[model samples]
Target: MELAIILMILLIVVAAAAIKLSDVGLTFPFSKKTNLYTPAERKFLQMLDMAVGDQYRIICRVRLSDIVSIRPNTSVKVSRSAMAQAATKQLDFVLCQKDTMSPVVAVDLVSVEAERSYKAQRDWYVSGALDAARIPHIRIKAKASYKPQEIRDCIHAKLAPLRFQQPQEPLVRGTLNNDKAPLRRPVAA
Candidate 1:
């Protein structure tokens, strides 16, 4: 009977350590492990960090309007230039590259719509086109002047077919930069 009570007490203690204890408000008991980002992922994160900067969170919703894939169709063959021109055209303003897959764009619809709405909506499509084109609204606004439904449909159509998987950076085989800086010195080998 004493052995059974001791075993029961040990099991309860182990369970308490694994789960959230009511004594602590909303605190889980497990130790966490963190994974680090790769160089390319770090660069991408840096760009996003630059774009969004101190605004860690935005209050407005964003939607991607449309995307057209650009290809290198014409080759300058007469000169026999064998270089498969590595000139990469700008894909989009906000893009997230997936592992072994094409990147996805996240457009700033709030900025886009706000800019268009401020211009009185129809200015871009009509005889107001010339005036609107010169006003700098086009640059700040979305490519397609979309309605609520249009924005929803556009994103659904574009993203529905694409599958986003976890980024694989070959499981970084080195120690982390303790100071969170890019400057790496020779560690004692």
Candidate 2:
């Protein structure tokens, strides 16, 4: 019992010493004020907001995976690693429907940095993914200030065609044979 008590006292002394030493220079968590959007980005986002108005909601810094998915068909399978890779990429902004939250268009901010090889590759991947999903995207160059009308024009030019595209009607086998004939299944012998 004596040995146990002494050991406990020694452990307490050691812990107290460590704590005293840590007071000299141990790092503690600190919170600093930081703006989420840079000045140029903020200006562009404001322009986008004015252009979209109440028709669509502008979402910023959306992950690529959040907006896209691999549509698995009966004959095709997707690997987990592929999905993880896509999740790492992100978009500058996305325009979504206010009521349904459905993504309407993706918008990318283009700057001089985008001319670099790595940035160009990233841009290609983003555009290709959006194309595969049949989502419209607009790449606008970064500017000090943007006119709301110009942004509106750009969105209209890109999305109008997609919205008005004609949907293909499913083929009816019986209709090709005879217009008046009713659809009927084959009789068993």
Candidate 3:
């Protein structure tokens, strides 16, 4: 009983010392971020929201693994390798269908300097993976300002191939057809 009490006291002293040391500057090396996005990313997010918010849901900073999955019937080794590669990468933004929440497009913001550096290699891998998954990937240059219309046009161009035409004519209401007189209700006799 005496040995157990002594050991407990020693452990308590050690823990107290560790806590005091942490107060001196040895605490966990992390703090909450003040802002979720940088100024440029915030600006672009606004533009993207304005451009397509009505049609699709925009999600930011999504992991690639969340957007894609390993194909079936693959060897275990290859599957593990593919998953490992995707796990560390992230998409800047993902445009998902409003109703189904299916990912329609992945967008990345690239600076000129990044394109000239090692980031280009990362982009190549991302592009290849997106292509293999049949998801459209768009890269927009990071800029101080973006026009919503321009952003809309760029997205539309990339999605044009996925659009299907309707076979039937749209109904036109509240108008005379073939120059006929408008229908009038009969007056009470």
Candidate 4:
């Protein structure tokens, strides 16, 4: 009887407190983000699109874990630690094959000052991990403007070996020797 009354009063008090907090706007205070990319990043994304054209798909703000994983042979503890670390770190952009969606290149946009500071520690880890996985990492200096052709040239140069490994189609239907037959004009003379 007495115990039941006290329990009922306590429950009502707790519920009242929660309702008051909600009425005061203390719950669900978050709002939607306005923009996904900063102005500089937006500009670079446009330039990257122009540079790669239809050759590759561009993924922005990719997590390291999405690109690489801990070895299967690793112990549980080490794997947990590696995953935790990878989950927090992210790459600025990743270029993937359009057909297979396999990540081929990782790009990081860094300011001159960030490159020289403690941020370099993060870069070192990202570089080592990508290197171990045999993925090419390209660091680009963020600036006000970029030339798409230069970006294309740089990407092609790095991907030269990959391009050679893939089978290429002939430019013409037949062999070059047969494509154009030489004329024997002096036979009649």
Candidate 5:
């Protein structure tokens, strides 16, 4: 009788521990979505995006100018402050150009899958773009993420401050350089 009671109590304790552990484990609070910037840095990106007037437009001419920025009120509520590292960009510096000051611009585009290969290039490109637009920005980078609509809204929100029209000659693909026999050498070398 004593052994049976002891075994039953042990089983009950084990089951209770497991139940409690599961309750904590299943919460998964840390599994919340990851972002590339902090709330503040996200706000900066949105502002910069707006100032640039959709130079990085994606397919369908769906300008990212409609995205809204994160409000200062909610910066504290965001969790990803650890990635708020500052970036140093060349365009942010001053260069003497014929006794005149001019902003520098550069571009290098890649699909989302190649992000790791050229992440530095991407950041510098964007920072240069913002500089070309004369949008003053903090030097810090942050981690943040949002839904597609939210991204769109953040862009739009930035664009709202400026007045501009769409470009007539939008970018389109051509096959001039895509042909198999793209070149021929001079007859008399």
Candidate 6:
């Protein structure tokens, strides 16, 4: 009879503990926020919109992974590690064809202030990758004011060559020449 009474008390203690634990639900006190863009970014975006006019679309915070891939024609296989590294990097902006959303250029807004070595290294990597991909990349300094004409000229300079060049074959069919280098800039199509 005593053992039965002890067993019943133990059961009640366990049940009480379980109930107490269950009462402590997880929650956060966060609320929805607005205006994700910073003041400088907003200003630059305005200038960029005016400069490009209706010819191209300006997209912000584009992932590098979306812009590049291990070319399909390459005999070399991209390792999982390489892809994971690429996924982490992102571009500040991408200028695309308005109707087709084809990326025409990639832009990075850099501060004149001294940055950490790692950030500089990452920037170098991004630049090299974009260059290899034959995607024109512009590095703009974060500035108090911008000249729309200058910006327009910069975009035009890069795009003018592409606009004139005619490709003999589609980009997908081009084969990779080596393991170390990226596929040759798709024969100007």
The root-mean-square deviation over C-alpha atoms between each candidate and the true structure, in angstroms, is 28.9, 10.3, 9.0, 5.9, 20.0, 12.8
Backbone clash numbers for all candidates listed: 0, 0, 0, 0, 24, 0
Worst 10 residues of 5 by lDDT: 59-68
Error of 1 at 103 (Å): 2.3
Worst 10 residues of 2 by lDDT: 73-82
Task: Output the worst ten-in-a-row residue range by lDDT, candidate 3.
Answer: 113-122
lDDT of 1 by residue, 37-95 (tens): 43433343444445544433311111211222122574557213322221211112343
| lDDT at residue 177 of model 5 (Cα atoms) | 65
Q: Over the stretch 134-176, how does candidate 3's per-residue lDDT look in tens digits?
A: 8999998887789999999999999887764434555665666
TM-score winner between 3 and 6, please give it: 3
lDDT of 2 by residue, 1-189 (tens): 999999999999999999999987776777875988878789999999999899899999999889888776623335465567678888889999998998989998877565672234446777888998888988888877789999999999999898669775656533545557676789998
Clashing pairs in 6: none
Q: How displaced is residue 96 in candidate 4, in Å?
A: 0.6
Candidate models: Cα lDDT each: 0.38, 0.83, 0.87, 0.85, 0.40, 0.80
**Candidate 4 displacement at residue 180 in angstroms:** 23
How does candidate 6 fare on TM-score? Answer: 0.69
Position 27, candidate 3: lDDT: 56
- What 10-residue stretch in candidate 1 is worst by lDDT? 58-67
- In model 1, state the lDDT of residue 96: 36
- Clashing pairs in model 2? none
> How does candidate 2 fare on TM-score?
0.69
Cα TM-score per model? 0.19, 0.69, 0.71, 0.73, 0.26, 0.69
Of 1 and 5, the candidate ahead on lDDT is 5
Among all candidates shown, the one with the greatest lDDT: 3
